[model samples]
Target: MSYVVTVERVEEQPAAVVHGRVDVDDLPEFLGRAFGDVLRTLATQHLHPVGPPFGRYQVDGDVFEVEAGFPCDGVPTPVGDVEPCTLPGGEVATTLHTGDYQRIGAAYQAVAEWMGEHHWQIAAAPWESYVDDPTVLEPRTIVRFPARRAS
Candidate 1:
């Protein structure tokens, strides 16, 4: 599917997250568990979430170092592996994908293609913020890559 990539400035958002180095095959389960942990942490600390859950990934071979959590209104007291972290704020090349999670890679591909054609250099690990419930037939997911124009 084709995507219309946009460059937009986003503010850094505080989040409570659980971090892990997970094999690709186990990512789904890991993210589910991590998200649950984050919610529990927020509840224990009486914090409210601000937005949809997100998973930031740094991939190496088939293993990924993942930070999975929900954006929160205020920083929460650390709970076990769930702690506070800030999502990077800056310009990002992004596109929305609406379909199965398995095909979300195409959204990333489209963003990368747009970035390459525009001489935008990736400034950090890319991430995806899921914007709708997975139970929906065509849920929207925003694929984002932090970037800067290359000299």
Candidate 2:
């Protein structure tokens, strides 16, 4: 699918997150388990999600150090591996992807190309917010790359 990348300001968001270093091939399972753990923890604690599930990825050679969770009201107590955290707020290059998760990389590539063209420097780990339920139909995800004008 084609993506229209755009730059926009994002506000700080509080979340419950789980971090782990996972191989690219194992990312799906890792994210699944991580989100499940977070959701369960929130339910057990009577915490409600304020937004959809989100994931941040930091590439390190062949593996990706990832943090996955859902945005929620003020941080809930740490439950096992899920911890309280915040998704940074600032300018970001973003695009929406409507399709399977396997094809989401194209959206990221589009954002990277846009960043390059605009001379924007990536300031933090990129993240993807799942906007639709994957089990029902084609999912919609917003891919975001935190950035700033090159100095």
Candidate 3:
């Protein structure tokens, strides 16, 4: 799939989050649990999601630490494994990927290449916004990386 990378400013967003460390093979299960708990909590609290679900990844070889959740209005009270948090936003390099989730790493690589070509530096952990339901025939996602000009 083709992707266009761009730099954009984003505002801080509130979300229900669950953090954990898991291997790439376990990502789907981790996301399911994290998003499920958050969605369930939101329903019980009458809170609605304001945007797509996302996962911030701090990658370490085959295993990674991830914080998964959905952006929502003001923070909801913590419930079960879900906690209230904010996705700090600023200048970011982002690109939309349309295909299977297994190919997402290519999107990340594309963004990193874009950053390098543009002399930008990654400022924080990268994240992926799930723009469509995973069960769809073609899943769409926006991979984002907080970035700034290289010193």
Clashes of each: 0, 0, 0
- List where candidate 2 sits over 4 angstroms from the true fold: none
Model 3 TM-score (2 dp): 0.91
Q: 33-104 in candidate 1: lDDT tens per residue?
A: 999999988988889889899999887998989999999989878878998998789999999999989898
Range of the 10 consecutive residues with the lowest summed lDDT in candidate 3: 79-88
Model 3 Cα lDDT, one tens digit per residue, 1-151? 7789999999988888998999999999999999999999988888889989999887799998989999997789987788988877899999999989888999999999999999999988888999999999999999999999998
- Provide C-alpha RMSD values for all models, in order: 1.4, 1.8, 1.5
Task: Enumerate residue pairs that collide in model 1.
Answer: none
Q: Tell me which residue pairs clash in candidate 2.
A: none
The 10-residue segment with the lowest total lDDT in model 1: 72-81
Write candidate 2's Cα lDDT for 92-151 as tens digits. 899999988878889988899889988998898889999987775788999989899997
TM-score of each: 0.92, 0.88, 0.91
Best-matching candidate per TM-score: 1
Model 3 CA lDDT for position 133: 92
- Computed on alpha carbons, the lDDT of every model, listed in order, comes to 0.91, 0.90, 0.91
